[model samples]
Target: MHQVIASPQGDKFIIARPGTRKGMQIPRAMHHELSSAVANGRDVPGWLVNAGREAWGLELSGQPARGNVLVRPVTPLNYSRATWEINKGCNFNCEHCYLAERAFEGLPRDEKDRLLSMLRDAGVLWLQFTGGEPTIDRDFPHSYRQAFILGMLVEILTNGSRLHRPEIIELLSAMPPHKVTVSLYGASPESFDSLTRKPGAFKLLTKGLKAAKEANVPLELALIVTKHNAHEVQAMREIADEYATTYTEYANISPTYDGNPQPLAAQAPGFLDKSSVFKGCPAGHTFFHVDPHGFATMCKVGRENPIGLMTEGLDGLLRLPAIADAQMLRSGGCSGCQLSATCRVCRPLAKAYQEAKAPLNTYCQHDNGDETA
Candidate 1:
């Protein structure tokens, strides 16, 4: 049996293992369903624990789950605004690399199709086509085109180095994503190459950003905050400040398990808070991540292959039992904490926190399962 904790504010249900983490972890639908059932005098004999069990459907280790490992699934809202890392590997090297592992490599075509279908079905509103460099994918054109054709908004996040390549530019020029996200590593050659490490990467990135502007396509800029360029945030913004589609992303340097950029920093402590309230990291529901190998996951972090191959189209993915279950698990990061307003949780870090069975690193500010407040 599980312990069900309800929020005093209203119908928010916090279902978790007796020893698991705390805070709101119930899906909005389930909470409403249960609340309505109670209000209507329906003989709902089962409590949230029952619903929790129904969703996970996993035979527990028989040992009680540690309270740190809470379960809060995704809801309709999260899936709608999910950020997808369609591609993993990158062309440029950043000092604070997060997605530099082997898994970042492109997935097989069939697998790619399945992942896209799932995202479409799950009602993912914005699809961010990213990678070591999303442009590196030989079939990126097809992938970008497919998302456009499906009515799912799409964006391509890249270093912009290859944007000038004839074939690459021709394709990007012809069919641009809803928005093109590029990193302004530096304002000049020194600052740029210092972070990217590549000799001419900084110039290429600038040229690419300009190219996107000239193409009349939308643009978004992502930066990894670090000692190298924290002071230059304002300067960097000046260059593409208008295109900062992301509300404001400032991530501390956290190294990827592998393939990270040079001059990596120690994982910092503290959680990047979010203003948005979510049942969980909207992986399976609000968003789906497809790796280069064709495997799909609810969250982009970790190698945990929750749902298998994408057998059906977008609709099919939405109906996936495991994905649904995961989405409902809980938002392990942004509930009831002081950081709730600005705390931006990282899925990969959250998953790593869960997998490593360690404390939240101060660098990424993840929960190490040990909470002070």
Candidate 2:
């Protein structure tokens, strides 16, 4: 007979020729079974046994559980802006690229298609497509159309390089992504290229922005505070007011920038991370970061590592060994912050953490005689 055996952790099942120990290990969602067991007196083994009966064509003695355990209960927030990296490689040579190692060219077409289905299955109703520059990908337009058909509200983050082309502009204006956020590196070529380290990038972005404005598409601007553009703060703010909604600012906290000499903190851009939303670590209550290579962690930057890609889906990811570690770190990162009440969760910070090693070497340098603003 074909059947499976459960582990004490309730995360894995060994599928064997009934009763054999040597079986293919499979990931199991523990929410309902574990919850039911805890609800019915911690008889986890019994609960799983019953769960197996139903999964493997056996008769359950009582009512069966419905729905996946890993999925959080549905609510209005399900569609609230989920971010996805559409492409990994970047065009610019910034001094502080956190994902410098992982950042490569675009994902394969088939990989993109698979990821779309995966996101949809994960209850992702809205997608914020970020990249080195999403506009650089040739399939981005088609990707946009596909996401739209899946009932997703799509957003894009681009350097605005390819957007100057009429074809790109026309599609964006016609369909209109839910939002388009552009990174305005500098006020002019001299200022922009100084930071991006790529001559002509500033001009390319400006051309793209102007076309976007002419296309009648809503455009927003972002700026990262770096040694190259700190003095442009006021100018950036004024420029933001010119045509964009708000200036979404970030600091110089990429992997390459950590532990390095930088301008004063007062010279850095103002920003917030999610921890500002709660009193302490919000690991369990709040969301966690899913790294580009696929690992789940507590605060994205902390040392805890609970789970990993044990299978083909996220169901397996939630059950990894590092989750608890991440959770503890998540709790600690939030619980002890001196400015917890005033702080906010910053994805870029988490992005840096997930993409680089800790002591993070960048923002966490609270000890340096140089904790600028």
Candidate 3:
């Protein structure tokens, strides 16, 4: 595996490690030189060796550019980021899961290889592998290694259940991810097991966390606060602090991606923080999401007008920007809302809430006398 990935992102050129955030912005001239050297099968440049040493403490001197450093080719597509749901499967049954049904299903190995290539061709420099729990998938190791081989910075969104497995740890240790984000259900075993509906969930999670930390895997914790574990928020923070890992809190729960309202029952009433104002996002334009079977959507939430990568391929993505625009328009219950100017929910998310017949107070700001929110 290449120690570093050198790729072009729009007008910028960056050299970054596969596992860590450490990177350096190189000038156009330097980028061109590196690209030419890789294309021509030349040795690593002296300047890059010195620079890598300075930036990431890497020793690249006397190494061949062909295998030691991966130089990604520029592509016609302008997309920079993407998220692929490896499979909608999980070991734990969290009540607050956004996926209504966790099914263990995805494309075959060859089809997945094709999809990753298409993503690379689409200029996706950063790729996130997510799932109901990505690590549980049998093809995860192959997919992860393939993404890294293609010179894309890979990030894993997992529950950390399988991190303790010897093969999983060994694979991660060999080809480090840009980051491994683990969701913390609860701090204590009782609360954690209860929330997940799995008796030994907490013990397994703790074991995985320790193993991943010992293996020096880059990790970030997502503290998923629900009614069942809201009381343990401080203890959760303490656990994160104990590991000296960065963490973010997720208190507000949403309905399932397919507009199912079951997950909303688990929302901690006191912890439902107001969402940030919905500024315009570059979902389909700069970034997109793909489901397990390779159907690409504008984002994870807006599952409308999916383009099946298995049949349609990269050309199908050309329609995404327009699809995204159509989906973002204020429609249905949100049409002509006076409060849309200040509303926090985007049109697609608002539509999901509408489909679920969620309480207006949960997502809408319109009062009873207003225009039928």
Best by TM-score: 3
Report the poorest 10 consecutive residues by lDDT, candidate 3.
Answer: 364-373
List ranges where model 2 is wrong by over 4 Å.
1-81, 256-311, 317-373
Candidate 1: worst-modelled 10 consecutive residues by lDDT: 1-10
| Clashes found in each candidate (C-alpha, N, C closer than 3 A) | 51, 20, 0
Candidate 3, after superposition: displacement of residue 88 in Å?
0.9
Can you write out model 3's per-residue Cα lDDT over 1-373, one digit (the tens) per residue?
6888788888888898888888998887888898888889888899999988998899988888888888777777768999999999999998888886789999999899999999999989899999888988889999998998898999889878888999999998888888898889899988898889898998898998899989999889999998889899999999887653599998877898789998888888767666777888888999999999999999999999899988988889999999999999988888877777777778888888889988876666444535465
Compare the candidates by lDDT and give the number of the best one: 3
Query: Would you list the C-alpha lDDT of every candidate in the order shown?
Result: 0.52, 0.52, 0.87
Sort order, lDDT high to low: 3, 1, 2
Residue-by-residue lDDT tens digits, candidate 1, 145-264: 666544455667777787666766666555445567676664667777877778888778776766656666566776655556655666776776754445245544444533242334
* TM per candidate: 0.59, 0.60, 0.95
Which of the two candidates, 2 or 3, achieves a greater TM-score against the reference? 3
Instruction: Write model 2 residue lDDT over 242-339, tens digit each, in one string.
Output: 76755687764444222222222223344322222423544422334343444434433442443442235656533433453344443333344564
Candidate 1 residue-wise lDDT at 351: 41
